[model samples]
Target: MTDFASEMRTLIEAIDTHNYNYYTLDRPVVSDAEYDKLYDRLVELEQTTGTTLPNSPTLRVGGELLKGFEPHRHLSRLWSLDKTRDKDGLNAWLTRVLKLVGDYNKNNPEQPLPHPTFVVELKFDGLTLNLTYDQGRLVQASTRGNGAVGEGILEQVKTIRSVPLEIPYKDGIIEVQGEGLMFLSVLDQYNQTAAEPLKNARNAAAGALRNLNPKTTAQRKLNAFFYNIGYSDNIRFDNHQEMVAFLKDNRFKVSPDTNYFDSIDDVMSQLEKIGSERLSYDFLIDGAVVKVADMRTREVLGYTDKFPRWAIAFKFEAEEVTTVLESVSWEVGRTGKITPVARVEPVDLAGVTVQNCTLNNIGDIERKNLKHALGSLVYIRRSNDVIPEILGKATEESDGEEIVCPTQCPACGTELEQRGAHLFCPNRLGCRPQMIGRITHFASRDAMDIDTFSVMTAEQLYQECGVRDPADLYKLTYDDLINLDRFGEKKANKLLAAFDKSKECDLSSFLFALGIPNTGKTTTRVLADHFGSLEKVMHASIEELISLHDVGGIVADSIYTFFRDPLMQDSIARMQAAGVQPRAEEKPAAAADESHPFFGKTIVLTGTLSAMSRDEAADRLEALGAKVTGSVSKKTDIVIAGESAGSKLAKAQSLGIRVIDDEQELLELLGLQQS
Candidate 1:
């Protein structure tokens, strides 16, 4: 085993040095991968050691137990810089800088403006934090709280290994300012389990920074790029570039999207270059920042009320691409909500390959005004940081009226019922598309342990091989799948093996896999634990479903709604008839398991988890006979906070519930240790 102490120190040194170079001096000597390896190694060691230094990398992620936040004063009066939200404002700011540099030349007559007169850099969209390093050690970090008065998060800041527990620069007083952003790779993992995934990187960053547990925060893989020295003097630079270069030399993370420009036009060129390059980078940035190059000109130009008089952030317009919309297809889910996917001539948007984009509901399709026949150029846009969304018609001239909802199910030729804008296939057990959606959703990692039954394969099974529902999925044979397109011998066997494994998943997973309307993971868990068997919930009355704590009137209504249909009930009978057993272990009629850490205690799960998958952890927690609930209420005994854990963490604090991490509390409870 590697010595946790030694590796932790080394990563702190390397990452700190790298940050010093990138953020402080505007120069970097290492690749992002190398930096990540060092950081991950340090995190691993810390997890194993569990011996925390006040300045240890783990401590910076924020403690789960919010001690209490009181309004605090700022050391200096913080003020907002004057901001320019568009290119014109940038042009105006550049004009001011040029005039100032020209005036300085006229005043001194001897000093000349630098040939390369401006620094253009990408402006990141993230939280700004202030780090105070005293005698080579990070003393505290605070949010640019109100830019003046900020909350003290000294303990939390210690978790960012790159934040540098100790800087090599001794006896130097420097406060570094940087924007904190969560990486994209981390965000995708979060979206899979998130009930409401973040819309963009800024949202992810906001969630991560506010996380109560530093351990949970660490999992997000947040990075920072220092843009300025909030306070540091005596060390001088000939130009802004030199100052950026100096910060890089001092071991701070810096933005790579920086360019030198001798004129406004040249700055514009760099800004355009950044526009093209922005999608390739991991962090979310709205636009490029332009600043006067002359060191003295920056001082002379000074501040506007909300932004720098000498600096401006010129934002790029949201990226739009024209593509031929080849087809408008309806994706009918198990719940009968139809989402129109605009299949287009394969076009690239931002960084992702985009051949399809959502048209939301039937109304959304009408608003876009795509007539039944397909080929039309449509405007598609996604903020460099957002999911690709269709931006209406690229063809401005169109007498296009909305396509009528199909009278029959496109897949099964059954009648469609119009409740609202949505056309539902009330033929629940008979709809092929609905069956495909339900089976795929059931086998998904969140619902059950079906390892490799992909949506594509599920569709193939339904359409080609005569499989309709999840119960039908259990009847699939290896040869049946192998006969389909692209299903070679090996993958078919692998998929079949996965299906076999899924059959054995605990009854709770089976119930969740059923994809019953309004039956989410929590409700399924409660029902399973209460009834101890799928047979009971199948026979449950509306009153019995309502008796569960998490199930209120709406949920009760949904359960009764699912059971009211003879076909739906017959389908459950069929699943049972097919030998698929769904049953939960009923909690014994007893007070609480004191040994069951969360028994009789109210608990709330917030954010995301690493190590044990969030669903698996929650399942295991309930298995231990604990009451796992959503949202932190006053009755909550503990809060299991995860990565990007949001408002629940705050509410838990307001209610004074003890909070624990997924890795620490949940994993340990489940007998899995995070390393």
Candidate 2:
């Protein structure tokens, strides 16, 4: 009997190893027949001994149907994340976090918190799962019904091949949090043979996991990716990196796309990249989550009434839906380009009512076969949180009334000219929409940043004050604005003051306000920085412009042509004559001593400094030519540790790099005396 039990244990371990290799790693070393032989041997040995191990692979085939799910109280509460849809919202959240950290540091000088770093992970669009493990064996699995408790689905969760039935950590009880998902490919395969196809992958995974029959759940072939060890009795992680390492060591399948960053700017860039590649993944993701990397920082930030304050979900705005295209209309832009706007039946998408979608141009309309799509169901997607865009018709065979392209400008009745894929109105000086759009863009925040400016203001000035061009804005008199319907003496004076203040603007803002075709804020800034003066940028050739970073052939041509245009040149001359002094940004002076200790060193700053914030220290280091990074690796030359320094300091010490723990010494190195 002891021999049979021992053989059963060996066979169970072998089968579990094979299952992990086949499902989690996606690399099967044994043939299907060999795996079947091992599984059969384990079943036979268990029958002979009449005692099945708790973690045996044979148990994964599932048990008899459960009557109903039991309630489970979680060891620790699972917190949801605060969400932001745009960069502005994200910046606001970051501002609040920094302010909170600053407030906390001011109140608790003895235990000042470290600068908050971040870890970004994909926010999977599926059911949240919490698994309980005790004595190294999977004890219970449940959905995250509420933060406090949930319905136990242990039998159904056992069907997930990637989930570990037993972990190497056998000390005590722990609760792991993750998402249970159905891969897009798996959903496709299941739908191909199913009598009733699952409409969505997220709903399919949720419905399967919540099903009463474990056998039905097993048939769906679900998968899961563990992220957080929410509850641990015998383990503690100092940071997110340590927690992730622990999860990986115990055979939990974690996402490899998880990344770490020290600055919010880098995190925003990563979120943008992830949003761009959202559709490339095998699973569905609605957003990316940004969490404070340090566990102590998370604790300090703590939880709000509903979500964790330390973490925020940057949600992507693109959501596809089908709506009927009612009709098409033509609209003129600031550049005199005529675009087709499709009026669709109002549909709620991504929390907004989308009634209008862009058809790009005549060429796009023809290419997408949308010219005959009026009164037909079409697929529309809200991309980047701007206007919803019409992708195409819902069905390939769907067709309706042919959309007629206008031959004259809708705003000024000027005959249109075909330029590549677009139809342009040549009457740039007379078109009302074009003139108003240009003036409004000129006063935009990224441009001149004029106060009290709006499209209505532009229209009032155009109709009543004869301010047709942007340069005409400078010519407005007190009598001209105060005579308008809603303008008061105080409002007129404020507008005039804003105009005067906008004259002493930087070169980048002046260039961006020009509304040059195909050139945005980034391109204009690059031009201003590279050329350093308006005259040099205006005189630059196509070849010179093309050599700058991010400047393509079309953009270079637009810049060159815009500068050479007689109207644009005249406008610039008028603006300059109106006391507009566009100055180049002042460059920082070189460090006084090239041999400064911080110069040219790869430095890592950890923990909290009582004297100054981490950003200020990083800025000073950067000015002295030191590269201050987030993490400590072999390439790191020095580590400056302050109070409460954690894993990074330990790693630096273990690597035998130079360490500076004394605040007085650090101040001295930075060319300052301790206060």
Highest TM-score against the true fold, candidate: 2
Off by over 4 Å in 2: 321-379, 382-675
For residue 6, give model 1's deviation from the true position in Å.
23
lDDT for model 1 comes to 0.67
lDDT of 2 at 133: 94
Question: Cα lDDT for residue 219, model 1?
Answer: 62
Residue 448 shift from truth in candidate 2, angstroms = 64
> How well is each residue in 1-675 modelled by candidate 1, as lDDT tens digits?
356666676666666677666644546898989877877877777677776555554455556666544443444434344445556876776667668767777887777655437787777767667777666677767766545556565555555545666756766666777777776766777778878676556656655666566666666667777777666533456687777776666666677666777777777777777888877877777777777777776676776533467676676776788887777777677777666677778876654567877665677676666653367677888533244667777776663344555677776777778866677777766777787888788788877667767889788787898877667776778778778998899988888787666655567777777777756677777777788876677778888877777776777787777766786676667766656665464445554335444555666677666555556666666655667775456767888887546677988888877767423224324433233
Candidate 1 backbone overlaps, count: 43
Superposed by TM-score, candidate 2 places the C-alpha of residue 14 at a distance from the truth, in angstroms, of 1.5
- Candidate 2's displacement at residue 323, Å, is 9.4
For candidate 1, the per-residue lDDT at 213 reads 62
